[model samples]
Target: MIGRPLILTTLVVAVLAVAALFVVPRLGGATAEASDLNLEAQPRLGASDAPVQIVVFEDYLCPACGQFAETVFPRLEREFVETGDAALYHKNFVVIGPESERVAHVGECVFREDEAAFWEFKRVAYRSQEGLNERRALDLVSEYLPGVDAEAVRTCAAEDLALEAVRSDVGTAQALGLRGTPSVLVDGSEVTATYAAVRTAVEAALAAR
Candidate 1:
């Protein structure tokens, strides 16, 4: 008993609403909740079956991310990730520029080569980010990942696979409504990307479990 005209009007309104939703958030430098966030293949540390999942969306060149890595990550690794209470994941949200994106791409390659090396790569990247050059990053990566092939990494990082890895990560970040680097999401809920917030959330999640 639905009239054609009524059906058409409803569809139009629905389309407009969806369009508006996408437009509104971008105007404020914020984003709508991301669609289809898959953390399965992302670089992770700690046990896979950990009760709490702490995901960080960050850029290599972001100073805040560096601060989080330096000030908070060690304690996090010790208190949660190392203890097997929680797993930490890094999702590349490359927004800084070419150098940042390049490093992100390299990070993907590093993670693929050795999951254990990814953590150190992040640590070294954050520690000596004053240069932020792609060549410098590659060199640092080699230094941290000694067995890794710098020339091979240079080739792989420039390949489509590496580009897509970082691109996909950035897409996931956007879908999660991340506004800036060092965004930590616990159980799909965005939390402050800080040691205190992450620890509290992890403890709470563990307690609840």
Candidate 2:
């Protein structure tokens, strides 16, 4: 009887060890692998072959995200994206509310139709972020993104045509265990969401490359 109890305890320990091997990686180790990010069919700024890849996780309704878009993004665009040192990709992590999801859907629709106009839509969304709602966001897109098909964007948002893409972004953010807006990743490592930190990380990645 003693030998049988000891054998059962050993088996239980072995089973837990195997289970942890699979669970631990999903919890933390996956965050370090940029390859895990789903970048396919996503809007990107800068050269495709840039040495460093920068990913920005944001929510449209988040004020901090708006601040980053207005203040830090331009510098990043001029210094890194334009220079071909890095490619920046935007991903959605809709944490605010229903309004945020609505905006994200519209943004994805614009991205699918015209990649260039999507950036304009982003700018206008943040510019008019105060008291923003679904109707205002769509109207802003119509007003600011002249190059985009306004009717098509409206229809797409109403029909939730781009919902899958937005959901994919949300899933990616959740998988990485991110819990906030404006999370910036440089070369697969999380960095402080500031131009100075981003610049430093980009430089370090470039130097390492």
Candidate 3:
């Protein structure tokens, strides 16, 4: 009787260990492939050689993403990005609609024109997200992003000049198995989409390095 109970206990432990092997990887333990990330040509903040790499997948029309941009992103920018502890890269998921894609194209155009102005355009785009359309998006870009060549951006979006770039970002997001906007990844591991979570992840990544 004693031997049988001990055997059952060992089996249970073995099963749980195997379960954790599968569960942990699903819960941010597995790192994504760097090549699939397509970090090249993406807009980024912080030093190029930062120890921690933070990737943010966002859709222009996602309200949660806007909230993150307005609140969480600023904290990350200050605490990690500005300090050169981590580099933040932006990628478009474009889950909303055609308008979202158009806005993304315009954003890419702004980035091409002036990388600095692209951040400003992002702020204005999120702030003016209500009832946003192609025309309104272009108008807001023109009105707010003074440094950007508004006419050039307008032409780029109208002619879909930046479509391939936007689509590439979308593909990258999908390849990483991101299911929603405002997904945050630190050192190629997905984390909860919040400032606290992201800060912790960044700190952990920094420590690991």
Candidate 4:
């Protein structure tokens, strides 16, 4: 997530929060080919056969990302993804710090332990993102993950296994030349930087298909 200009500059020297990235794969994963409708990355929303595919690069610690989660994402989910006109794929691009990676690891752990809870964790992460760094954000994972062992979650979040998923996402984002948070690719084109632009792009992609 990209911070507002002021906060972005302030946090740059502090090294607390994270940023987002989006990368397009040249040969594998979701790519330019029509056949690469890989829904395995994020399966909660969207249809594999849908006409419009939206790939998002987000960081849990990015405040601008929180804005998307609150405003744009819900609208997209209700208007396109839920209706099966579009599929939204979530990929982790860790631009923040180790704390950013930790939050992502918690997400992966939540996904492995409980699929439904993973989304819940994402929501909580965004909700609690204000005024917190990576360590504090990682601590808040327990609040949303119902019935999860807090100690275990914390431990796993700090381990390499969970962090690897985040690292891989960063690699993917670098490859795609993603410059900032909440970057989006509609079908095979990257044009979703603003809310208005993304809505228009998604609608057009759906209408075309």
Candidate 5:
């Protein structure tokens, strides 16, 4: 499911991330301890017993996040999430602006009705992120989630459901010392922000298990 534009940039991001590691501040020293893993806060996308956990923090408006969702995410789901090797918990980190939180709130509203809807919104919103703002965030939900109560989602989004949890996610990212969007912590260790690197880390975690 990797698109042409995404494929062109994945490796480039990988290379740059490796080079930037030293320059970027390493917050919690690259390891999120298992005891510190917060599964209760966000929507998790994998089985309970999965040996590895890929905690995702990203903004819907972030382009690097779109690239990750397009290129690395499918493979991760197929080889890890579906196979019960690793779990993914996508947390909201709205660095773009208030609009990012609005979109996240819509996702929260959808999650109340259907977990699947929330995931779908994440995908579609990212694909359709161009020119998106607080107002248009609701429009994307209406267009994409026809089956769900779009109006309710808009209401909840305006009210900002689970807004504290989004703040918590931001704190988690800060503790990890993240430098940018589309970052992952594989088994509590911060790897290069790329699917290939994450997959390799997951394999290592699996082998260790």
Candidate 6:
């Protein structure tokens, strides 16, 4: 019995030491990986059946996010997303803080009304980042999404559905241990945050799936 307890103690100490050395560093590395992954690119761009799936997490206020939207999104949409070769998804990390969260909520509200128009609203929102005002966002949404009722947009955005959607996106980022914007996930694996890196990952995912 004394030998058994001694052996048990030894095993416990070894396990704890191993955890301190290996598990802690791995956890920290995972966190850093997640922070590097978050970005604001739109998600699920191609057909549901499309082999490639890319999930982009981005913050509206991040300059890098702006660059990706302004420079890369259109090209991706035209070349890969529209052509059914690739699909992209969006997760709002809200790195700009409160305002970004508000914008994400509003965008989600717009998405609920009309998914097709949602992309247009996103395009316009990113374009108007400098002069973003919530009220103006509502107005711009109306202008861009012709058939969507602005009042409904406002109400939904301020209420449950859209709020939940935005929260869910944020939650997804947190769950992935991401701390920043411009994150891209290829086949559910976190990778680099650049457009080129994302494109290559998407292509590989497409080939695989």
Per-residue alpha-carbon lDDT of model 1 for 22-141, expressed as tens digits? 998766333223235566788888877888787788898999988988888788888888788888888899778878988888888887787778778888888888877677777887
Better of 2 and 5 by lDDT: 2
lDDT of 2 by residue, 87-168 (tens): 9989999999988988898999999899999888888899999998889988998888888899999999989999999999
Each candidate: what lDDT? 0.79, 0.88, 0.85, 0.70, 0.79, 0.73
TM-score of 2: 0.84
Q: Residues 59-173, candidate 4: write the lDDT tens digits.
A: 8888888898888888877888888788877778777776777677777767666666677777788888876555665567666566666677666766645676667767767
Cα lDDT tens digits, model 5, 149-194, are: 8878777777876567677777878776776788788878878778
TM-score of each prediction: 0.80, 0.84, 0.85, 0.74, 0.81, 0.75
Off by over 4 Å in 1: 1-35
List model 3 lDDT by residue over 84-129, tens digit each.
8988888898888988988888888888888788888888899888
> Considering lDDT, where higher is better, how would the candidates rank from best to worst?
2, 3, 1, 5, 6, 4
Output the worst ten-in-a-row residue range by lDDT, candidate 6: 28-37
Clashes of each: 2, 0, 0, 6, 1, 19
Report model 5's TM-score to 2 decimal places: 0.81
On TM-score, the leading prediction is 3
Candidate 2: worst-modelled 10 consecutive residues by lDDT: 25-34
Q: Which pairs clash in model 2?
A: none
Whole-model lDDT, model 5: 0.79
- Indicate the worst ten consecutive residues by lDDT in candidate 1: 28-37
